[model samples]
Target: MTSSNIPIATPTFGQLLRSPVLLLAFGFGSGLAKKAPGTFGTVAAIPLWYGLQFLSPVAYLAVIAVTFALGCYLCGAASKKLGVHDHGGIVWDEFVGYWLTMFMAPAGWLWALYGFVLFRIFDIAKPQPIGWADRRVHGGLGIMLDDILAGIYAALVLQGTAYLIHML
Candidate 1:
């Protein structure tokens, strides 16, 4: 069958939640949104970031490490089941990416919002290495890698901006 003609099966929300991988891959149902699922997934990430924000830097890093690993597995598995690579519904990457973007960010709603905006910008823009990874990678690691890079890029910019503001 032609690539376009291949059938892609998307699991229902009930089906997705039945599996740990699918549940996370769908961003706890945020990815099931009829419109702008990625945006919804990112929004869902905000509260998680808030909860995780208080972790010590070392603990935060540990959590990010684990989340990235879990996201890679779950995202890959869900994409395989859905018969699509990087399906829009596979948004665990977005969740991890946003959390990483806000890592160690100063405590404030404004900072959180800024991190959200910057992460979404970099993710959607897919500039440089992020775009390269997205195009060339496959499977679960591939699914999570691009967003991870985007998050790192956003984190750098966010941290640098905070530093500059402090210096000023």
Candidate 2:
């Protein structure tokens, strides 16, 4: 049954903590927040993004590839468990989305902050292809696609802003 027809089963925080897929899909418990779970999920990604800084650009890209694949599976699994597709609690998408947005960004906390803002704006806005993917895609891949597009949009804007700043 579709989530709308059936009652959605809300997992307890402890249940979420116990399941690896749920834990990752929930952005390491950031999704457990009573409000703005997506925002918190994105924030939870900061440490990961910071850790990624040590990798070379190529390695970073590789990690993103693996993470995206994993996100799709975990997010889909979580959605299935919750009886919802792309539920708010399935926030692994946001983590990877933010990471993609910050790919090759200027090296600094300020730049990361800027990337975070831009990613959030684009993800929330869902312009063009992102909106299209959100509507058209389904399953695990769908969960990741829209956010990936949003991240790309954010990355473009962030890169342009950084370039302009550099010029100035």
The residue pairs found clashing in candidate 1 are none
Instruction: List, residue by residue over 30-137, the lDDT tens digit for candidate 1.
Output: 998888888899999999889899999999999999999988888877777777889897889999999999999988999999999999999999999999999999
What does candidate 1 score on TM?
0.93
Candidate 2 runs further than 4 Å off: 1-8
> In candidate 2, how many Å is residue 156 off?
0.9
Model 1 score (lDDT): 0.89
lDDT value for candidate 2? 0.88
What is candidate 1's CA lDDT for residue 27?
Answer: 91
Q: Report the lDDT tens digits of candidate 2 across residue range 1-168.
A: 233667355566888777888888998788888888889999999899999978999999999999999988998888887787888877899999999999989899999999999999988988898899999999999999999999999999989998999999
